[model samples]
Target: QYRLQYKMTVREELYRQIKAHLDLIGINAADELFIFDGEADAEVYNRAVKHVDLWNHNVEFLEQETPWERPAVFIEFQPIKWKAIVTGVEYRADVFANLHVVTDWNEGDGIGEFQLLEKIHEVLAGLCGSNFMEFDIDTSMTNHNHEEVVENIETYHCIGFRHLK
Candidate 1:
C-alpha cells in the first residue's frame, strides 16, 4: 500500500514561508538607513537584524518591565478559517497578519523606525511564495510605548491554499 503525507496546514505553511522571507531580507538594528537607488544596498542594510520572531503576546515587554533589544521585528498571525475547495482534497483561506516593527525612539534622531518600516513594507508587500500568493499591505499605524519604543504595525493580507495528493 502507498500513502501520501501532509506536513502542515495552510496557516502554518503560510507563516513559515513569510517568516523565511523576512529572515532572508534581514532586519538590522542600525542607526541610519542608507537609502540608495540600488537594490543590493537595501539587502545589505537589512541584514543587520537584531531580533525577529513570532509574537507570543508577551505583556511584560509592553509593560516596560522587561528589557529587550533596541530594534526588533515580530510577526503576528491572525485566526484563519479554512474553506473546502474541492470537497475534501483542497482547502483555501484568506490569511491576515501584522508585522510589528519596533525601534527605540531615542536612537538616530527618532525617525529610523519609520525608515525601517518603509524598507520592511517594500520587501514584504507583494511577496509571492510557493504555497502562498502575493501579500498586500492593508494598513499601517504607529504606537508609542512607555519604554520609548516605537512600533509601526503593518497589516498584510494574502491567500493561502492547501491540497492533498
Candidate 2:
C-alpha cells in the first residue's frame, strides 16, 4: 500500500518554527497561535475583538478554494483596531508571504529552526514594513483609517515550496 504525507504536518511544523521565532523575540505566541484547516472563521475575529489581547491568532493551509489559494499557508492576525468595525467586517484574503531564497525549502517540509528565523523575519519585514530585510509584496494590501493607521499584523500568507521530497 502507498500513503501520502499531509500538508498539515508541514503547516504544523512551520507554525512551531514561527511560534518559536516570535517567542525568541519575547512573545508568548504559542498560547496565542492556532491552526484551522477550513474556511476562515468570523468567530475567531469576534473572539479576537472581544479579547483583543487574548484571542488565538490562526493559520491555515490552503487546498485551493480558488486560484488565490496557491500559497503554502495563510495566517489570520488580530485586527489593528476594534471599534466601529461594523457588524460583518470584511476580511481581505490578499497577502504574499515568501523569503528570497533565504533558506532551502526544497529538501522537505521541515525548514530547520535557524533557517526559519530568517524566513519569518523576511515575511514580517515585507508585510509589516520593517526594514530588517528587503522583499517584494505586490500581493499585499493594507486598510487605513484617518492616517492613524494600525496595520493588520495578525494575518499573513507564507509562500513556500509544496513538493515533499
What is the overall TM-score of model 1 with all chains considered together? 0.74
- Model 2's C-alpha root-mean-square deviation from the true structure amounts to 19.9
lDDT value for model 2: 0.29
**What tens-digit string does per-residue lDDT give for candidate 2 at 1-165?**
888765443334444444433332211234232222233432332211111111122122113222221111233332222222234542212223332111112334333323333344543444222111222333333222212112233334433222323
Evaluated at residue 74, the lDDT of candidate 1 is: 74
The C-alpha TM-scores of every prediction are 0.74, 0.25
Off by more than 4 A, model 1: 2-8, 24-46, 59-68
| lDDT tens per residue, model 1, 108-156 | 5766667777766766778766567878889898876546667778899
Q: Best candidate per TM-score, number?
A: 1
